[model samples]
Target: MKKLNCLIGAIIKDQNWAVIPFGNTILEPDDQVIIVTIPENASKIREMLEGGPVRTNHIMEE
Candidate 1:
């Protein structure tokens, strides 16, 4: 998530309380990770999370 300029604020597993995450934090398959970033970089951020670029169709009207 670093490549996307996103920060992992915390991680929550099961119903336990959230814990502050760090660079070396190990994310589990079911762990819920919270990230913080700006809105301008949302697309790129989402792409990073989704593992690839998301294709969008730009419709033109005449």
Candidate 2:
């Protein structure tokens, strides 16, 4: 996950088993992860989770 404001929802590991997770939380197999982000960083966040090459931050002042 990028260094942006992310709201992770409850993680359901098994039937009737769910808990709120934090940033430092470690995910386990069969864990359901939910995330909410802004439109601007949607692609960035997707690439990050997919383990793809992310674009570097650049400033282009017209």
Candidate 3:
């Protein structure tokens, strides 16, 4: 199994536009998120979050 460390945050949508809150934010309806996840489970995580891929430069060593 792989471990992913992600900063789970949220975003809001309004009038065909989207916004992401900053600092000590709370989740709201239509809020999106920015998260970091492992490459293997990235796709599934994205689907769950209703978002897209997270950019990563590090890989896990076994």
Candidate 4:
């Protein structure tokens, strides 16, 4: 999530398991994730996460 300026704090899988996320973690199709980000970026991040088009040209270059 470095690209989106957010961190994935944890992931809950199948209503029975919770896993802390790491840089190399891979999310499953039905897994629920917890993301931590600033309020300013929430909508953009949501758009990206939901498979909507994001205008990367507007992203601030870190």
- Highest lDDT: give the candidate number: 4
> What is the C-alpha lDDT profile of model 3 across 1-62, one tens digit per residue?
12223433333245343333333344444343444445665665444444323332232322
Best by TM-score: 4
**Candidate 2 structure quality by residue, lDDT tens digits, 2-38:** 3323434455555554554545455444445555445
By lDDT, the better pick of 1 and 3 is 1
Q: Rank the candidates by TM-score, best first.
A: 4, 1, 2, 3
For model 1, how does the per-residue alpha-carbon lDDT over 1-62 read when each residue is reduced to its tens digit? Answer: 22333444555566675854544444444545565545655555456556433221221222
Q: Rank the candidates by lDDT, best first.
A: 4, 1, 2, 3
Reference-based TM-score of each model:
0.42, 0.41, 0.30, 0.44
Predicted structure 2: lDDT: 0.45
Taking all chains together, the TM-score of candidate 2 against the true structure is 0.41
**Candidate 4 lDDT by residue in tens digits, 1-62:** 32333544555555664654544454555546666555676676567667523222222322
Greater-lDDT candidate between 1 and 2 = 1
